[model samples]
Target chain A: MASALRVLGVDPGLTRCGVGVIDVAPNRAASLVHVGVVRSSPDLPIERRLKAIAEGIRAVLDEHRPHVVAVERVFAQNNRHSVMGTAQASGIALLLAAEHGVPAHTHTPSEVKAAISGYGSADKRQVQTMVARVLRLDALPQPADAADALALALCHAWRSGGTATGGGAVTSLTPAQRAWADAEKLARR
Target chain B: MASALRVLGVDPGLTRCGVGVIDVAPNRAASLVHVGVVRSSPDLPIERRLKAIAEGIRAVLDEHRPHVVAVERVFAQNNRHSVMGTAQASGIALLLAAEHGVPAHTHTPSEVKAAISGYGSADKRQVQTMVARVLRLDALPQPADAADALALALCHAWRSGGTATGGGAVTSLTPAQRAWADAEKLARR
Candidate 1:
């Protein structure tokens, strides 16, 4: 709460990792601090690809110093291949957050779509249009993945944070869920 | 030794994993190359992504790199994501040869696909045709994931590097999946 919050939304991709950071200043507008994609071709070796993704994101996190990270949650789209790859990339994004001690939250595709486009079933084009409008970008973002990831971050800002989030982070959790998680942790032993 | 060895193939993706590998050489090629997929998606949370995928593949033995560790038998696919967010990273790749001082292998997707396809199935479009032509690829190269993984490495010359496997100096088996693993070991003793 003391520190200014910056939200970085990532549309995780195995081949193309899209990262966008928005700086939210108190009583002011959210500025687009960073946006880009970590591009890796499917033709390269897996090891090299992973390093690039990790390093690329690490740079964004370190450079932007975002308070929390918001990522596009992985939704099962029946396309097994797409789902699996997205999950892996998402995992890496979480790892980046965890490693950095930054809390990372995942938003479902529908939820993300709804927040940005006001329609869960909104196609990629529609989501992009709204993201551009919300961010007040002069032109539509390039590489749909990048724009989508940025939009996810923007959605997080709308729902939470200083002016948003309704109440402090304490009320952020339901007592029941918190108790269940504590019990689950004890059970792991 | 005359019989072809077991090989496991791996196809890494966001959700629909395609694994198939078989042992095949100039002559000896047999047995099943384990194949299946783990699904993960944008719908799932970051933690679930790890849970769903089992976070990619791991093996029981250095059985893959049948030859030397210097050259990996199977080249990792160049899915840009694999490089940045690999399930295991260098520590995991060290598996085949790292512990025992043996070597791990690396292979490109095309090489592995070619081993199954007379020609390389370099693109996704070619995968179906190549998958259809699998007569010569499986000597003991197990699943498509295993086979593909090994094909990349074995393509380099299983004949010369026949000693690339157990004979290497690397302590191959990981503690996570070591030959002596048991419940007691995991009990924090």
Candidate 2:
């Protein structure tokens, strides 16, 4: 039997960085390993704030030692004020993943939503609900960022075919094609 | 006489990251210590590209041991395709500064131009010419990125009053006021 694949997901932000780790079995069963947010005050200097974020993420990476990392893909078309910070935070996450010898991948918000809820346009509440159901958690993940992180982790697992099935074939699909494929996967299950 | 203040300047970009080191005496006279660009091919994975940038900057920091770091502040309003990479690269520079126990500051393009040429609207050629003149270099700094990096270092020195006159007061001036003040400084010299 193939072993479970562990994934670390990051929804990067300067003020509130959300991170989650989960294990996905070959049969597609998912279980949470850890979930939390790293917060830095807006009042701190930019360097100091980024340092705090680096330390927080480092601690998580050291403890979890996940097989792969999944980060939310930020776009320039997003909120102009926060986009720069978001991109910076994501960079730190990606750099840390490389330093730890873990391969990192970025999934767009729509890809995450589609992977978790079978709909790219799903709302936050819907995505949260789906994450809870998928993980068999007693409650919905609080703070949309954390849920987003978990959703990202799940998206990576499912999109990569849970590693158990040798997920390489899934990487070639277009975004639209991937989304529908994910939706169909959910229907079959 | 106060000791010369050393600054490491970075014009952050994924493809061609510019780095320069300069020594500024209290009298606001600037001398170039080193200048170069770190290139990363876009064909590589994003993580590999970032790692190459990080190693390049880290090597420069280790070699020069500058007193401070200055990076060009990226804006979301800039070229959309490249702004994200620029911000990410800047993030690595700033984070490395913090890790190395050096202070880091960011200046916009206009700020660098005004500090170098006493005009916020100065073109690249004008700013490059001024930098070459100030540094008493035999020739122009090749590659616009390298020139921009040297300009940023000089800007940091001048804007911070070059550490000889105690630059705390300059931080309070508006952009227009600072540009005019810089112009006056050049006129008097």
Candidate 3:
């Protein structure tokens, strides 16, 4: 049987970046490995804050060593002040993923919400409840961002077919899925 | 006298990033060291393109070892299609600078135009012409982005007191300037 796939998810931000790690078994069961936020003081210079975020990501990567990374994609329609910082933080995440030879994927907020809660427009509370239930945790993860990060990881795992059916075996991948896997392998190399 | 300071300027973009390096003497005289563009195919995935940019900036930093790095600050009002990519590329530049122990500064477009052409709203052609004249180049640099990058470096140098009077020494810095300098030193340490 193929071993479980480990994934790291990042919710990029300048002041409070969220990171989550999970392992998805071939049978589609997911177990949370870790979750937390990397905070930077707003009073510091922008570059320093960026550095802090990068360092935090580096530490997480070192500790978790996930096979793949999923980051939230920033869109222009987001808050102006947040859009830029989010983009910058996302860049750092992607760059570090490339440097560490880990394949990185981006998931939109709606996509993550849909994957977790079965609704594209699921609110934060709904999403949080779903994530906690899916992971079978006793309590919801604190700091809404961390829950969102976990949802992103789960979304990628399910969308990529890391989950199996009732038969509990891997199914054949679609051509597009095969291509993405090939690209991920190439990127790692 | 303090030795001439080398500066690397970046005009951040995912498709066509511009890089320029120059040496500014204590008396403010500037000489061009290098100029080039980092191009990424639009057909590639966004992460691959961003990786290409980060690699390009890394190569420049390795070759130039500039005392400082200057990047054009990206604003939200820029072309919607380009703004996120620009911010991402800018983040890479700043991260690389911090990694290499080089101070990085951001200059707004208007500041670069004013420093080179004596008008904040100067058109591109005017800024290019002034940049060529200031650097005593035989002809204007090809690709307007490269010219803007050179202008950004020159602006940082001139404004930071790289050029001085007969005393040929730095003048008293403003409180903001002092704070920036302190941050740079701390980042290097």
Candidate 4:
């Protein structure tokens, strides 16, 4: 059996950022490693709130040392205010992943739901139940955001068909993946 | 006359981020220091593009050592795709400011236009012309984003009523300014 791949998934937000870590075996079984939320007060200034979020994420990276980082993709929506905050938080997640040399990917909400529950339009309750069952958790993870994060990690692991060995061993690469790798190399230059 | 305060303004974007630096005198006279755009190819992956932008901004910070950093505040608008990218870039600007210990501020587009042109609803040409005239430049800055960036820096300097020496020196503090300062302190803690 290929070694388990550790994935860190982030559900980015300004007030409460959800983070979950999981180890996925090659056979597609997933086990929970860590799950929590990073909270920042809305009373704070924008930059200060962002700083706290970045620091919180950095601390998580230091503690868990996940092989890969997965973030939820922000889409255009009617709630501009909410979307802007989500995008900002998502940027911090991607930046931290790059700073730590971890490969980062983004999965849409629907993609995550489909991957975990086999239904793109699965409701929140359905996703939560499925995530719990997949990870063998005795009960659903509190906070819908935490369950969403775990789903993101699982989606990326299954889609990529690769194990993230903290040491940076990628098992397979498609042309697009090769392009991403080349682009990352150029960015570091 | 007190020493001039150097300010770096950013009009954040994913594909083309506008950056401008200026030195504002105690008497409110402004002179341009640097103005340019950081371009990242759309063909690159999002993380790679973000990494390029962060590196580009870091290089600017290293070279300029500006007293403060100013970013154009993003507003909710139609076109969710564009807004998301702007917010992401804005987040990077704030994070970089904190990482380098430089105070960061945000100014709205109307605020910038009013400060530079005395008209909140000024047209693009009006803003470009006013920015050139204020800096005593012989010609208008190319690429409207660059000129907008210069306007953002000038707006913050005029509104803040103080220099950003990182020493908390200010002529006066409004309730909002005080709140921002307190939040920044808490973030640094």
**Which is superior by TM-score, 1 or 3?**
3
Classify candidate 2 by CAPRI docking class.
Answer: medium
Candidate 2 lDDT for residue B175: 48
TM-scores, chain A, per candidate:
0.79, 0.87, 0.85, 0.84
Interface RMSD of 3: 1.4
Candidate 2 on B1-189: residue-level lDDT in tens?
Answer: 248899999999999999999998766667889999998999977777888899999999999999999999988888668888899999989999999988889999998988778779989998888888778888899899999999999888877776522254456776446645654564456
Candidate 1 ranges beyond 4 A from true positions: A1-3, A25-28, A161-189, B1-189
- DockQ for each of the predicted structures, in order? 0.08, 0.71, 0.51, 0.50
lDDT-superior candidate, 1 or 2: 2
The list of candidate 4 runs beyond 4 A from truth reads A78-80, A163-189, B165-189
Summarize candidate 1's per-residue lDDT along A37-120 as a digit string, tens digits.
988668644445555676788899898888788887654433445454565567667767766767778777777766556556
Chain A TM-score (model 1) = 0.79
Give lDDT tens digits, candidate 4, residues A145-185: 88888878877777666455223235566423432343233
Q: Give the backbone clash total of model 2.
A: 0
* Tens digits of lDDT, candidate 1, B100-128: 34444455555544433334545543443
Better of 2 and 3 by lDDT: 2
- Cα lDDT tens digits, model 3, B49-155, are 88899899889999988888889998876756888888999998888888888778888988776666655787999878767776778898889878878888877
Which candidate tops lDDT?
A: 2
